[model samples]
Target chain A: MSTPENWTPQERQLHDALHRSAERVQPGPDGLARIRRRTAVVPMWRRPVVLGLAGATALAAAVIVGGVIALNDGDDDAPVASQTSTSPAPSPSDTTAQTAPPTTPPAETTPPAQSLTVPVYYVADSGDGLRLVREFHAIETSLTPIAAAVNEMLTAPPADPDYRSLWAPGVEVTAADLADGAIVVDLSAPPTAGEDPDLAAQQLVYTATAAAASAGQDGSLPVRITVGGQDPSEPIGRTDPLEVRQLVQLNDPAEGATLPSPVTVTGEAAVYEANVLWELRRDGEVVDSGNTTAEECCTFSPFSLELDLEPGAYQIVVSESDESGGEGRPPMSDSRTFTVE
Target chain B: MVQDRTGSEADDAITDLYAAHYVRLVRLATLLLGNEAVAEEVVQDAFVALHSRWRRLREPAAAVAYLRTSVVHGSRSVQRRRGVAARHPDEPPGHAPSAEQVAVGGAAADAVVEALRGLPHRQREALVLRYYGGLSEAEIASAMKISNGAVKSHASRGLAGLREAMADWS
Candidate 1:
């Protein structure tokens, strides 16, 4: 289709000759079978199958909507995992917290005694705008989740091929500490090198807030970022201004966590009108699907749904529909696969 | 609910894709990677990833394009993992040229390959996808995740460089 106007007859002859030559190379005889055998069992933990496989355990996980909370100190008094007609299945370990006082707010009052995989946000340039990409980074419980996540951000590049980072070379999050109920982040250098300064700033803010939320930090804290100790008032493109919990995040069914039918999906999302769409698929076919509303919208708030399916390998995907209600762009979404027993 | 992927319609589709495109993709990969074994591995991985994400693929018709893109990226990652030069110390037996290799059979083919290999990765990819893969500029751009203009730029520069190198070889 790309014929060159200035092409020499000899060059055209060479192109034809090269094309004919490359066509002769062949793969080995068993190449097809080998590829099929290798790819036969695509693990359920892949991107589409966000939830891990469900086993025979049949533990119903109750979706804890509203806010992501830190695991309580009294392991002995953890709420008992339970099954209610309408409640989402609860993981075995989370059963003890079933009786947790709903009124109490979670705080970073105590250091985590357990490890957590904190979701760090990075920017994916979509040509039109920058979309936030999330990747879970594992941190030792000994390290504060927020601080550790920022440190990880400095060295870790986005694993997704479509996404990249704007963090300039040698850009370091010098300090990340909670004071006056806000997470103050000190950066060695600004991410001004990127195409958009606002997106670069949001990348840091979203990642920091999500990290804090994942660690069970009180979601009330706002991320206040300072470059070289100077505050950039009203950091551009601030999404969640009200509370830290405004981060649209999945708090339950931790990545790769197994679950049972009537599985409850819970996460924080900031949608146009608190609406989130959920679909359940087993073996790539939709089995059950619907929409659920979060507590509120225009900010990250908790939402929950209970899905019942016959025992099988299933992936649950949750997405926020675009406001126009037209399928213009890919909806912001998250998914996980879990086996239903 | 057990979503049975093995031996199901999805598996059948994968098998069909494997049968239809496996060799061509292998050739494509080999052209990009300059090695047979790694090309095989990269194509296999692409299929596996495709199978895993099959459900998310909005259009089943785009599977070929999807496979092409995945193979391209997979080959890039392999090259990256292997460092600047993907030197395979464990080169399998048969360093000897195949009958097919003998058939194409000349210093010109070798010179073309050498010239193609010497170009920058983007330029080489643009040319291979264009001439060898027989992709349109738009298709090449989609496969490489770049703009059409970029695709045209890379291909033109690549072809010019290849011609220059071939002239020197003569």
Candidate 2:
């Protein structure tokens, strides 16, 4: 490479401009801390069994992977109806099953079913276009994780008003099972193709795959969609996140979570220079505003922020910085209303 | 005593390398990836990977080379995924001047960055490594996993492309 002394004026200008463009990029103070934390965690490949149960915490930790550890002997067909009765009370036999040793036979132990959190994908309008977003919902079910997640994706209204399912209401999962390394989902009726047919199919594809992954199955499995007794369509697989997902997403302090002080906000975003901006609001009034950078820019990567706040209901909205300098479309954002006590 | 000394030596090497090169490596990655957060992650991952294989890479110079190559490879993987995601036929042109650019009033620099973002991945990588990273042709070639001749061609083509893209600025 030619030295700076040998550079032509044009080359010098280019060099100067490049340096100036990145001059403002002073990385956050937590880089070393973050790297240490990641290094400390045993890589998933080294601990495959623990990988399946990785994010299961508190209430969801009791959820048995694969859903084969039948917690309830109740009729599997009436999962919703049985939910109310089984939640508040564990039968005498269920208590015995819970205390049984690991050596006990599978046929003898029947523990009570517990609520588990499953990720459900929903469609939302990201200023530029419609894309998929996800929310974790705690559901009490005796059915497999894939079945419960698909059922919720079909039936439940998203907690966030900005998000909605493209799947028509009243549609239910007839069956959801892993077969031949792909998830096969059977629906009660064929879903009407929305404005975007591929994205519409992707809603279920993302949901089923996410549910499968959470339940310890391969998350990358293509989803085979069968409507009624009809033949299945070409298997739907996950599209690149940048194309199908909102550019900004908030993954922590889930919608309406109540927790203590020093709340940690984290999510993934693909924004210019990885600049993620945020605003905290209480009763629709802005209380705090700031910015954080994601791990990388122009593609979805993780970003996190910590906030210490007094007791109150707050809405934290995170967005991409307006790279257009106020000329292009509004920056995409995701927000959640949470409380701190 | 020998095991303890080796362990402490390893820790010292990592600490010294981190202090000396962490920020610089992150900046290099940010220039390549156009996302500071991802760049930091890429560099951090490089450090973590280097730590695991530190015994094999005892020399500081060799460790630094390992980091640069890892960052380059990591950035390439990220760009490949992004390329697939951004393959939409109707996607718009390159990035516009950001809010910070407007605030700082560095329209000229912003224009150059925007033009750079529009270049092909290899060409951009080559140019960033040469002009901004100040790496020699051989170093660039090693980091990018390409031949020295390829690096020269990519840098020349990238410079020409940037000039054309930023023609309005000049």
Candidate 3:
């Protein structure tokens, strides 16, 4: 390699070409000139403080654009599902909406809030076009335990596994909402053995709350959860067949729940399952039994039944029909008494 | 306010630096970038960055080196954008210019760009500083974060390759 000292004709000509190219460049526009002038006028130290805010604005825009693009490009077909927002409220048509037909006796209760308070709503698909619904708050993203537990469920195959984990392990969960008032969570039970079942259950709670919170309700999450057709535990109230009573608005004067709106039941029950027995009972005697079928699987059976009745301490009994045409030994439901004038 | 210096004094210094170095830096950037408009934008961006960090800039003496390095990095960005340019760092074989080719005018510039763009990002920066900005090999090496030997070798190889590809441009 010849040095610059060699005076090669080509080397010198290359140098000349560079100069010609350099000559065509214009100075930066007015904004830059203004920056020049400001830097010219301000004390050197103050320039940073001023520029810092300005720089932040530019950085904020760049970050918004970049982060959006990064998030968008992270997955081609689907954007990152924000683990936060009420994960897609199970619309009215979700197929896993098979709840027992509601036979809950509607007790004279407080009017429902103008808006329903939901902590979380997790809607997922059962690969065979069947959708499963569950909800809760504060789902964890520590990810490992959930992953292992899910793997265990897959391998163990309880009776028959309803949902094959479609999501892979280690995929980052994206968050969307922050309303932790009432959570509808999907299961976090990993398929692996020796997994902390408590943590897994809490994962369900955490995700539901986080999603509900992200969706914008206050953090006091009253949560409900469902796996397959069975309630995770026992009913919040005593009712047959419809055993998942986490959703029952337990109108306990003792519990201090004052409804600003009419009380309504929102969930899924099978058509063949005992039709929803929306009852009206005053001190245990049946006042009115408003009945409706859940009509679909994994759907939101929002029974907005209006019973014109006088009130004083009434119990609402909502129950489900089993495959054997009977209510679950203990039904899924709640009872609340109110003074409706 | 920069505590070390008072208001107007610091202002004058900043103004003087901008006035003196702005155009030359743009030209230097232009040489590496091969696009005049882009060079100016790169220079403006570098200056803005400098302004933001002006307080932490302890030594005015190193500002020129700071500016040159900024231009070099900016030129690399241009190369990334162009995609048509940047290639392997390997040197092309040297070729003598024919008598007919030596007569070409500014058309020779297009060939220069073609050859320089072919050089590695670092080698191109080294050559631009050495020949266009007239910086010494040591100065070029310091600005480029490379050793003097590396600068010498890169410049030599860059020139040799330019001789081959730009032989037709004269």
Candidate 4:
């Protein structure tokens, strides 16, 4: 096969035509500003020094809690579920002293300073399939971002009106460490008994990777899961080591994520001939919409569109075209709800 | 207050890089994703990630490769999400292109884009990286994380498919 250099006149014409088409496309102003907003400097939680300090603080808190347990009259069954912070608090010692213990409950400690807004990924109903709901949990920066994020995922109840967590509340993040750009996350139990373990694994992968990015890892890292000290024989969902999370999904403007007017909806899709449809709706009424082409078709490809809308709630739906070029057959689609401010 | 010179210096370098490469990178993403707005978001996202890891990137020259890799991976994610959106049948149809859009670029340009989109992902990536991106085969391989031989095959197949798709285009 000939390269572009040796291509026939027709091939050369096609190449030129392709170039001209690209030349017509240009990003709107504020592109840089938008990027700056999404990416900020890694916080103190990711730093080794602060993480060490957090460990010491946790140890001290554990000792205080142990003393509180000793003061109680052998009420060893005190529930540990009340303090649902992302960092795992140490359990109280079981050794009982000969002296009589007090009966008063321990006072709540003051919250830590400098909290980080970490995105916790949860599975929510989206049509027939599950779409990710990203909820921000503000945890002390002293807590390691990974531990805190995962801990919250396990303990914090889903706050979104319609969202829910599939991982068992008893599940715990035994340990998490970054290895060779991949995070090895140890869990106390298997994530969930749901029919598709892959989706459950994805929730963890998305949460961990997002936490990593928030902590300053520019690239999204893959996650390897181990349960009760053994790597599961089955595969766990991980960000494509060679690719980003989209693999055939959208990442931007997460569900229930708010945005400004003239919002841009972005995602990935492999459709018939790269023909994808995008529509904007408010309260089930079509506001504005358009059909756009992706970079490639018949395989995973990138798709996006920009819509101008009033400041209000709107749902953006992107779908694949059917055989009649989006005329007749039922099309497959992905949708996200976002507020325009 | 005294500030660290190295930190500020790194920030300045990234600012300069963004000024110089933002448009080019956005266009690259636009070619990969086929939407200007989404392409812009992807490019911006790449730059932000780059900013976060700028120090580790080591050499200034490596920044372009890093951005390219990020854009490619990001596009994959966007496509996957789009595929899910396409599954439900109740949504309204997308708006057709405005008359102004067609008149501005003409039908031939549209056909080229439509035909280019028809190619497989790898082939389209190879062609866009080579023709519009003006990157060498080695660079494309590096950006795509594919072998050099695979790049050549994809480019050849992509050109062949494009030629066939646009057979009737004037």
Model 2 misplacement above 4 A? A1-112, B1-170
Model 4 chain A lDDT-worst window of ten: A91-100
Give the CA lDDT, 0 to 100, for residue A311 in model 1.
77
User: Which DockQ-derived CAPRI band holds candidate 2?
Assistant: incorrect
lDDT of 1 by residue, B10-119 (tens): 66678678778887888777777777767777888888788777777736669899999999998888866762233243332223556766565444666677677788
Q: Model 2 chain A: which ten-residue window has the lowest total lDDT? A: A49-58
Clashes of 2: 7
Best by DockQ: 4
Between candidates 2 and 3, the one scoring higher on DockQ is: 3
User: Which candidate wins on lDDT?
Assistant: 2
Residue A208 displacement (Å), model 2: 1.1
TM-score of each: 0.44, 0.45, 0.34, 0.39
Q: What is the alpha-carbon lDDT for the whole of candidate 1?
A: 0.59
Can you write out model 2's per-residue Cα lDDT over B1-170, one digit (the tens) per residue?
Answer: 00112244655576677778888887777777777756776888898888778888899988988999999899889755653224222212113446876576467776777788888989988988888888899999999999999999998899889877566666
Give the DockQ-based CAPRI class for model 1: incorrect
- Comparing only chain A of model 2 with the true chain A, what is the TM-score? 0.65
Candidate 2's DockQ: 0.17
As for TM-score, the candidate ahead, 1 or 2, is 2
